[model samples]
Target: MFADARKIAELAWPVLIGQLAIIAFGVIDTAMVGRYSAVDLAALGLGSSIYISVYIGLTGILTALQPIAAQLHGARRYSEIGEEVRQSLWLALALMTIGFLILYFPGPVLRLARVPAALHERTLAYLQILAFGLPASLVFRVYSSLTNALGQPRLVMILQIGALLLKFPLNTWLIFGGLGVPALGGPGCALASITINWTLAIVGMLLLTKLDVFRELAIFSHFCWPVWRRQAAQLRLGIPMGLSYLIEVTSYTFMALFIARFGTTTLAGHQIAGNVGAVLYMTPLSIGIAASTLVAQALGAHRHEAARTLSRHGILMAVLIACCYALMLLVLRPLIIEGYTPNLQVAAAAMPLVLIVAFYHVFDSLQVTTAFVLRAYKVAVVPTVIYAVALWGVGLGGGYLLGFDVGGAIPVWLTGARGFWVANTASLAIAGFGLLIYWRGVSKRYLQVDAVGQVR
Candidate 1:
């Protein structure tokens, strides 16, 4: 137990820090844009929703690469890891191309959302500029996952920190027209993001090449048709998992759109709360990643008991972390909300929602952690189905019915956002418990076979 606990922590800490750094990049950007002008800030709020919806959706699809690579690595099939990475790269490239094409000409789509006319042009410009980063961003994700799976998460952290450090100055110079550059304002944020994406990808690739484990895989070797077949096997296993992620994340993204109908202030306040929730949630998210890696590696070694033990340890750690964050938010809600925006109206409107997010984070942690456990077992489809039903059925449906159909006020609509979290929490609770039951059943079956052999 102690050994398993230690392993989970060892893997989770670096990942947690890396996740926090990513969140810091977003928060810093929001702060900088807010400082520049409210309108720019608002445009960023809207544009970012669009950007993340696609970025996260595609990345979620590519998430299968990590567990697949990790399982292969654990089994000492190093050559297959490289092939899987290559296939993922191609998949990411294809997805990014589609995203860019759509975002570049998003007029018809944005119009369908019922957003305010005044903000339309700025949001479109911001979206288009941000679209340029999609390919590089997706490429970086593949590299990050591959390296991390090779048990070098520290390198991923270093690369991400380098990117985070550069993002601020890059945005400053490009947005405000410093260093002899023209003032691009909100669009500058997109430009800076694109620059950072490519830099991270290049630096990460160079660093990854230095690692003996990856060097052995010779991932840069010419793509083989047979290798592509192996890669397709990974996608077949992973795509369902990816779709599960999309279903859950898209539910929230859709909620963001629903909130936007209330007005810019509501949407901006919602962004702040959502961003804070995201940052805080990363603590557990890192734990989830750790669980995925540990569980997958354990399964590959056929240590089913060790895998189950590690998962329990992860859940315990996640709950402890969630409690700490919940308390902090409850104690410092005003300070946290006001820190993001000075608008009294926005702050006041956001307070209750922030508190609600604290509660939501608990279930969010459980769902993600358990989901990763399932992914580790390569049991992706069942969890995906559970998430789809919980997210859309209980969460989104409830929110839509309560917020728009019943209350019909912005604050009421805002409160309705919690429904998704509620449903998420319930679903994860059921799934986590179900996983425990399944694990026990498998252990009993193995024990029964061993007992029979012993009697013979």
Candidate 2:
């Protein structure tokens, strides 16, 4: 048990750091844009709310590559793993192309959302520019998943660092027009991201080709219909997992729409809180990824006992990290909000919301980590259903009833946000507990298989 715990921790730490860096990029981007104007910041926020639906929704489905690849690696099926990678590359390309088409037609969608006329143009521009990065982003995810599955998470960290480095200077140049280039304002950040993503994807592909295990498999040498079908099977397993993530993320996306209707200032505050929460969320998010990979690999090796043991330790570690994160948010809530926005009202409005988010992060951690593990077992449907119910039934439904339907003073609306958080936490707790139960049953079945010598 101790050995398994150590292995999980080793895998999770680098991933946790990489997640933090990704979050930091958002924070930096928000802070930089905030300096320009509150309207610019608001536009970025609203635009991002729409953009994230595509980014996370598609990436979530593609992320299934991690556990699938890890399981194959653990089973010593190197050739199959190579085939899976090739299929994932093609799958990512298709998804990215579809996403690009969607981005090109954002006017209809933005009009549907009924965003303020003033913010609409900027938001559309930002969305279009950001759309160009989708292909690179998807490709990067595939490479990152393959490397992590190979038990080398540090490569991801390095790749992320490289991307971030490029982002900072390019953002500065394009956003502010520093290098004899016309300032593109809010849209500039998206352009910078697109450039950085393509660079990372190309570099990641090169690095992947050089890996020892991948080289030995010669998966690059073969391309056939059978391999494509097998890869499609993995995607089928991943779709539910992807949908589960979409359900959760889309709930928040809809919530952002509701907040947008309130006013630009309100939307800006909401965006700040959301970005901060996303940054803090990196810790648990990375831990979940690590847990998923470890659990899948252990199961593939027919070490059901080890898989269960790793999950227990991973959950414990995740909870502890969540606690620390919540504590930091509590102590530095004001500083955190103030750092991002110069507008006094925006900062004040966002402060209370940050507190609500702090609480959400705790349970959010548990639910996400547990869900990742459940997906590794290919039991995604139940978790997806649970998420839909929680987000809509509790979080969104409760927020509407409390915030507006049962209207009152400003304090009441403020409290309503917290009520939404409470609903989210409750739903996450239920889902997390349910998954633990399901995992126990799966573990027992695997154990019986081992006893019957069917595992080998």
Candidate 3:
């Protein structure tokens, strides 16, 4: 048990740091932009909704590389890993094009949301500037996925933290206006992100090319054209993975949009709570990533018992840590809300939501950890269906019904943007339970496999 814990931690801490760094990027944006004006803060919130929907959906597809590469690494099929990396990049480019189209022509969502004229143009600018970095961001995803799979999460962590470090100064300069640069507000953060993303991509490329850890893999020795067959194989796994991510992210994104109608203070408060929830989520997400890597590798090596042990221990680790985080949030909820903004209304609105997160975040850990482990087994389609039903159907739909007081029974406290979060929490609970059941089946099947790896 101790060994399993250590191994999971060994991989998880770097991933946690890296994930926190990424979340810090958003945190900085929220904190800095909120002080600019409620209008720009609201724009940042809305724009982030659209951007995260696109970015997460696209990057989620490329995550197929992690399990695939990890399995290959465990099986000692070193050379094949490079080819997979190249193919993932091809997929990334294709995904980048699709993301650009969505961000560039966000007519449907914008129309659906009916953003006010005061906020629309700034929101559009934020999304558009962010669109320019899609290519670099996707490439960076590929790099991060590959190295993490290779058991080199520290490499990815270092680079991501560096990007986070650079983002603050850049955000200040571009956002506040200095050295002849005009104040650009929210959109300026997007520009800073674009620059940081490209820089990370370049650094990742150089590292992949030069590092001994990756040398044997030769990930970029020669550019290979996209092979249709290989692309299809990745798509088979990638598409459902992507859709699951889309479903999860869009649920939150659309919640923001729906909450937007309530007023800027409500939206800003939601943003703070959402950011807080996201930061807390990174703990389980990192554990899941680490566990999935180990799980995939164990399966590839035909160590079914090891895989089972790691999965159990990993899930436990995430849940336990989540409880600790939730406890901390319960105590620090006031201070945390204050850190986001000075606006009294926004702070008041966000406090209760943070209180809810204190509990829901536990289920969040379960769902994310189980989902990532399922992905290690290449079981994504069921998870996709599960997310659609749980998050989109129950969470989003229920939130709409309750938030708008559609049936006229919602309590006042639960009838505003707060209702959306309550619904989302319930959704995570459903998802967590659902995934837990499914993982049991997967583990049983995996353990049933014989010496030649044929499931009995």
lDDT (CA) per prediction: 0.76, 0.79, 0.89
Flag regions of model 3 displaced more than 4 Å. Answer: 33-42, 105-120, 178-183, 260-269, 331-351, 405-418, 451-456
Cα TM-score per model: 0.86, 0.88, 0.90
lDDT digits (tens) for residues 1-456 of candidate 3: 789989999999999999888878878998898877788998998888778878888888899999999989989999999999999988998899999988888768777779999888888888889889889999999999998888889999999888888999999999998999999999998999999999999999999888899988988888799989878878888889989988887788789879989999888888888878888888899999999999999988978778878988999899999999999999988888888789898898888888988988999999999999988888899988999999998899989988899989889988888898899999999999999899899888877665446533
Best of the two (2, 3) by lDDT: 3
Candidate ordering by TM-score (highest first): 3, 2, 1
Taking the tens digit of each residue's C-alpha lDDT, what string does model 2 give over 16-131?
88887787678778877787767778889888777887888788778888888888887988887888888888888789988898886798888887889789888888988888
Q: After superposition, how far is residue 359 of candidate 3 from its true place, in Å?
A: 1.8
- Weakest ten-residue segment in model 2 by summed lDDT: 409-418
- Tell me how many clashing residue pairs each candidate has: 0, 0, 0
State the displacement of the C-alpha of residue 321, model 3, in Å, after optimal TM-score superposition: 1.4
* Ranking of candidates on lDDT, top first: 3, 2, 1
Alpha carbon deviation, residue 72, candidate 2 (Å) = 0.7
Q: Which is superior by lDDT, 1 or 3? A: 3
lDDT of 2: 0.79
> Candidate 1 lDDT (Cα, whole model)?
0.76
Q: Per-residue lDDT tens digits of candidate 1, residues 1-456?
A: 667667877888888888888888878888887887788888898888778777876777787888888888778788878878777877887788888987798887788867687778778988998788788888888887886676678878887888888988898898888777998778888889988988887887776577676787878766554456755766776678768767877877777778777678777777777887788778888888888898777766656666768877877778777888889999999999989899998887677678778877777777777777767777776677777777777667766665564655445433444444444445555555555555455545645655777799
Better of 1 and 3 by TM-score: 3
